[model samples]
Target chain A: MHEQDTEGVKIGLEVHCQLTSLATKLFCSSPSDYRGKPPNTNICPVCIGTPGSLPVLNRKAVTHAAMIALALNFKIPERMLFFRKNYFYPDMAKNFQITQYDRAGGVPFATDGHITLDSGKRIRIGRMQLEEDPAKLSYDGTIESSTQTFVDYNRAGITLVEIVTDPDFESPREAREFLNKLSSILEHLSVSDLNLEGSVRCDANISMAGGRRVEVKNISSFKEVERALNFEITRQRSLTSKGIKVMQETRHWDEIRRITISLRLKEEEQDYRYFPEADLVPVTLTKQFVQDVKKGMPEMPEERAKRFQKDYHLSGETAQILVREKALADFFEEAAKHSKDARQLGSWLAVDLQAYLNEYGKSLEELKLTPKHFAEMANMVSSGEVSRGAAKTAFVEMLKTGRMPRSISEEKGLKVISDTGFVESLIDKIFSENPQAVQDALKDPKAVNFLLGQIMRATKGRVDPAVANRLVRERLAAAKGSK
Target chain B: MTKKQRQEQFISEKEVEHLAELAKLELSKKEFTKLRGELNEILGYFRLIDEVDTENVSPTYHVQDIVNVLRDDTPTPQQPDMLLEDAPQKKDRFIKAPKMI
Candidate 1:
């Protein structure tokens, strides 16, 4: 569909994408990838703003920020500036967040107007900026003194792409669809990884009747965003209906409770003290750079969707499910390369594999088995060596022991019996024993069909139905004339 | 264009205060009054956008650039213990604290 066809509702979104740089802090060269490491160990005198550790900007981080702005059709400043956004928080060892204020560290996002979507629907652009992320909060065990909070700077000081949208969304669902589209674009760009720890965070400002918009904070998931906005809208609407006003404040999404609770009052626009950064020079996207980035951009979601349909012959639903996570899509393609039937590959990944993952609340990437192993299983089922039902059992075994599909099938002896001679012998005994079926077989084709049903039932679902039917017909025809 | 449009486009100070309360923010009356005009102006701007023939416009939630950037199946570290060292309380490798005291 053309991007122009999608303008039915007033919706807007603010997207924050994290850049997982190898460097810890944007200004302080601590360490960026903080997985499974001691927290304070990852910190440094500079990151904590110790008196003499002067801050130096990570040039790579600045470039990443600029790249995102350019992709969004924002005007990049020739010079970049950094600002100390004053806020009190324990997560910030410095007690204040150093971020790119108004025009993000000289790479301020000066989005003049609208961004056109693949749907051809144009949503007005607000501003995009770069900022250093704050350390994440580690909640203690108990709410009331049961636990204490901790800070992990692993996420702190990493560069972030903050894109604000004009208030263009009218409903919760639109906001959801828009977020999905954004995640796809960021995935295609390789700039942000949503599945990472605390990588993408969302805040929604919802209002109606020109009433005050209460900004919902720290909604990390798209599902949570949908729920929070819906609840907040109802909360706001009821308040307004009952002569209550919608205050401009911040609220938290209690994901556990599925409710938005008040956190703090809304800050004034001046409260953020958004000023241009002074230290860095503004960056200008040369016509050359924009072209280069555009060239580097992989086929977008829509294009990839079409390609999956064309290349893999996947149903629209199957392709969409695989593409939801780039890793899953890669897994499907990699495994399909080894498989004989692409449809079986798709079904295994989209339906059967996902069913198991859901039971465990995991994803395919989290499994231990490789794509080669997965395809082997798919191949076995498609070749009719094992029933699709039996293939699931073999798959579990593969996951458990990393065994080959053939060996797992042998160990369980779940192979189907398709020999026509063996089945024809069984059919002869059955026809002589059931005199009633023989008499009816000569009387009516429909009654003869009932005897075939009995033969299949006798095999315990091990025999192939088509082979059994063919034998039953030949055996029954000869017996009728001989009698 | 009509009374509905004018009424729909305006934001009131009282409503701002209510929204602030829902957000759990303690706003000064002064800020509440000023936000009304600013809110309306912003609303007015949105109204201008609402008028644009967006019948074909697609809303972009994310600026497309990044695709799934994932780590290898290697397990990343969880939060470190030192972070919790300064916690108000601790109990057997977990955070412990007083009851709302």
Candidate 2:
């Protein structure tokens, strides 16, 4: 095995999720709603680490952490201890940050968990811990050239659930997929909104076979995470192929430049000398308390996706995509309530509506279309009240004006022309006007489609193509009989 | 210096220099020697507590036995300008620090 080698890559993620759903900071009563606020507004004595101002852990923060743990199927420890992670940074008002350490009598809120991706690949979760968020820092210019840095303490002291993952991902795409699924799970658990700035952040460590590991940090978005990993993988492979060993170092993702830049060498001491946090006592969670939290847990994405496939007869892929966003899933269920045909509603939502949203870079929440109207539109198409094309037209109009599908169809004259006599008359007129076309239709069956196209154009595409085709054939046969 | 000084010296003068570097302080040669001696004496006094250790004693993290201190998750209006007024240097609403290298 050692003689010949397969160059395999290993990836691990350390993801940070902000517990914005909680009401207060991790250790203080200051508002956790720090986003978009002016700098330093949310700062309190305890958050800014004022001397002699002791910290009291927020009980709700612990509950939220435990809820996330249960949602991820992690084993909640009996007693969770906090530790002082000693570091020096302006963002940390306290020179030492209170975090969960794995050693030195430090116990995190949860440990030993795993979440499976939609592909059925399991990614083991190392630990999930609760920690305080540091302040926000902004540079006046490029970080390398800036003459000054600005600090906003508004984000300081907010609680964060840091989830660490085992080295399981073999590709950038798998890592991205894992993050998306994890974010959806967190959203479904109501532990996080996942849309707020800095609500979720990821740091990835990547290494190729026989190559030193490189850690990429400061990747803010899901897409950036994938791109950063991809860039690192290629960089490492090229170095290894050229007989150059990859240096183990901390790299920064220059998102704008779309490249990874080395930030620090391995020789630098990572002195986060963690010791037990003396201000706050350990959080004790009994089995009964965990059971209570577990009882209130909502159905996660995996179960809901399975239900969608089983009940609605949706495909596994479609169900997976639909359940990726909780709001979209809710919309699907709401529309399903109005229409008995789940397949019709599922296809429209998962395909047409989703396509439109993607085209305009809009979200389901941003669209003005309601589920009631969406269901009505789907019903109209299925009931032969409107052709599929006409229904789609009404959908776009409804999306733009926020009007009901019925009223939009009425206003746009999109109602299907299903009356047999009226369609016969329209075909009769088209035949009389185009004698050459009629002669051509009598000679060739496909020529009747030309006349049918005319009726469709005259009716503004409200006439179903099948009905138009049938009426045109009947009228053409009647003409041939008269001859 | 305290009377409870330990015979064994744990923190050397070099260790003081390293600590000063980490704190980003520039200590003069005279000040370095003076501070090193004072810090060592302080550590020597702290060593006396090691003699009374009980191996079975559980670690105490906090003085109070109370737990589960929490506040309702809600926002209270804050005067950001008032807080910024205390900063020695500020631009707009943010506190300014030296450009990190």
Candidate 3:
């Protein structure tokens, strides 16, 4: 987006990264593992909002939020209040979402990051606040399939932090990068698994100022975010130009139409009729409390990426790849930390090793691999005993068979035949076996090439191609001298 | 004091019913009528405890315990070899349904 002298476009994104904390949910002490438990099994009063039963707030959720807020450089409110954001939807067992609005009560922060857009412009961040989440509903496109209309309330109360940024993002690409960076940071803090379904949600609000702000809701994935925002921007621009008033409203992205359909007129605070949550007590934080919470942070991703590059001597791409997911990055470093060839170790983790892990539908912990195992595999590839392709084949078999890399190479007879004595003996047998090919090798100017081909064919490709060529050339020169 | 506290403490039939409607709960007239007293008793407790000089009591919402409540994360559990054959919709390795809304 070229910065023009026209009406400026401001985009503030509200992102939610579900903190997959300690496995229990936000309001109740129920396991938040949605896939593990049968549907309706994880439901409890707090999530289903059973009357007469009060919510005993989850302290870890708050601490996790505080850890994130401090990381984002926001002031902890003297009092944090949860208000019932009144709305009704089948997905929400509780008609009202118990959310934190201005109830964060006057906390001010302005963070500026250079958001590099696909069009090559940088957008800034306004501020990012922390918030809770609602349960998810799957659309089976049925009016009523009493059975298929399912709601998994397990995710109802997971601790989530929302990072809101300024509309400095001119294009959708920049918005995606911002989300990627933010999610990476959250993962580094061990706050979430980036792959967890509905773990992170991005809502991109776009406007071309002749029109009103068109807020696109619950853009499920990052790819959808780009398409939805681009579509909305175009739609609003077209509508405003036609003299149709672009009414301020919240719109849902119809993924099927790839268009935005207005859900309801965007209501001001006066509509929900804001009120304090009478059931829950207000939260207050002190200077000392802030200091204490700051100490509990997990390692931030950016700093770790820099160290991985500098200390491990890995390339920027490799470091970024490893650090994108915290566990894999940690695994790479732990295994390769004491090794001599950090570069080789880094590539194995960033490349072939990653592909192997992906094929298993597993992360680092699922397979029996450590940094020591990775280094051992790297050392085999770096040595000339086994070829790169052979080493990869060996690596997979080693993972499956739990055999040592060298042992696997030996068992498979993959060792390269670099020994000159062995090559000469194989060459002598090949020349005697094929006299016509030998005469062709002696007579043709490219005769040595024919001789080398026979040598390689006889060796079953175990001999290094380069070494075979040299040995054949030497023997051909010796035969000419005798002639 | 928040309007929530004021309303919960003082008792309001209107807001209570609204909350019930939000929760999709069907409460009888007796349950709704008697709910005000019970909520008052509950909110009343927070009202008194609010005065405790928790000046230093960092409201502990989650205790600081680090336990990994995780699984090896395998595929969805095995399907019954013979999915109740009398079921409504069955397709190739899938169950079909009527035209979804």
Candidate 4:
């Protein structure tokens, strides 16, 4: 389907991903796993900005950010500095967020990179910086209507890496594709788990027809980014077509209403007095350290896709699908280790198993079917111990019950009946019952399918269709010879 | 110099008001004038550093000659109940604040 002509539309994205792989908060010894804990329970003095508490940087977060920088082809500076961005908000007890700045004698963690979308459009990454997340605030109602707000400092001081892209996306679809690709890269780096709720957030800036830029914030999910941009673009187009000027302002994406409401006017722009953060020292990335990080990098998505195609003899489409998700690709590799037919196993995973996953709206990690089970099912089909149809039934049962394929097949009587004596007797009974149909099959090749259908119905779809086909054809030819 | 000229030479009352707003400070008229005068005096002291003409010297972001003072990514035990004892207002386990719009 052709997308609507979004001519003259430009969108840029600022994605903030939490470095959830770290064991502790960015500047404190508080645990990073604070999703289910009570509010303010996982916080420390450094995170909550208690009086006289100093912040010490988490070394692993920097290395993880460096790995992401390398994966995206960013240039790491010799030294990176943190600045205190001064603002007054209840979410931050410190009243100033410790972050990296590219201006005012401060350098970001990395800069100058690009990620090419599947459509081959290169979205230039302007910069990637490290920052701390603010505490989460929950309202009794909506933000505008709520009278009281509860503060949860558990999420505060968590390490966040913000990736800013240049205004290179022409449409919402392209923006969504870029985010998916970025997520895949992050997954391969083992830096962050994107599946966690509120783990990744995006803010988008969009403009059309030389209008002033409008930023849409609070896009909490990957899918919502596209929806928010589409809504913003349509809203702007309506205004521009009516000869109205799009005002430059910040808007919030209301997930419930599916609209962008003006959060603040550009006139009330924040004056974040950024200055050097004295509590934390600068992190020096020497050439040796960068080289060490680069050396320790794992296989990225692109390389894994290429390897899948070459090593497993998989089609380009299948390889692309498998590698699009790191978990699915890992599952395929583990299954391939024990299967004799890697290509078959790859297609079963990329196509059939994926269909079931999509149908059930569950992720591969949530499934009970193991790689060993998948390999066993594929091997059974390869060796003709079970028909493809029977194996499919067994596969479904396995998914539902978390049972092994062999046991499921035995319980459901789905194994192929390959015994020649039993099959010969069934065929003889069918021939005696329908001699005229047998004679018709001897004359017409297409009539053989009718006989095969009969055999299938008689065997309750348990017979290997290939074995039954050969036997029925042989029996028909012998009868013709005798006549 | 006239009072207006002296005020212009240092910091203006309008600029002081803007800074106060940003810092979420509710300042009275007298306090604003006092802060403006005190801030100008502080700025006058800082202006002495402008005489240094080492144009080739890079800007110093930190006074200490240290880099990479980092801690390992390890979690220590936390006492939430003890920490909550300091809250002025609490709802369940949460820190409650005034109505925010």
Best by TM-score: 4
Global local distance difference test of model 2: 0.83
Task: Give one digit per residue, the lDDT tens place, for model 2 in B1-101.
Answer: 34435455669977887788667689999999888878877888777789896799987766788665555666555555665677789888888987766
Q: Which candidate do you rate higher for TM-score, 1 or 3? A: 1
User: Once model 1 is optimally superposed onto the true structure by TM-score, how far is the C-alpha of residue A316 displaced, in angstroms?
Assistant: 3.3
Whichever of 1 and 4 has more DockQ, that candidate is 4
TM-score of each: 0.63, 0.80, 0.58, 0.83
Give the per-residue lDDT of model 2 (tens digit) for A351-442.
Answer: 98888887888887877677898788888888888888778888888877788988888888888988888988888788889999999999
Query: On residues A20-114, what C-alpha lDDT tens digit does candidate 1 reach at each position?
Result: 64344566666677667555555555555455555566656655565566556677654444566654455566656666555332335455534
lDDT of 3 by residue, A1-483 (tens): 322222455566877777775456665665667655544455556665656656555666666776766655555665555666666554555567666665334332123333343345555555544444665555455434445544545566655666677667766656666666666667777677767667777787777666667788977766577677767766776776788988878888777878888774432223454455556655656577678877777777667877988988889888877876777787887778656677888887888777887778666666675677777777766666665655777788867766677787888887778888988899888878878876677788576677776765665556777787877777777877898
The true-versus-predicted C-alpha distance at residue A258 of model 1, in Å, is 4.4
RMSD of 3: 12.4
lDDT of 4 by residue, A87-192 (tens): 8777888989999999998999999989987667799999999999999998877777888878899999999999999999999999988887899899999999
Worst 10-residue lDDT window, candidate 3 chain A: A104-113
Tens-digit lDDT string for candidate 4 (B1-101): 34554454367777887788788789988998789888987776666678889799988889999899999999999877787788888888888887755
For all candidates in order, the CA lDDT equals 0.66, 0.83, 0.65, 0.88
Q: For candidate 2, what is the TM-score?
A: 0.80
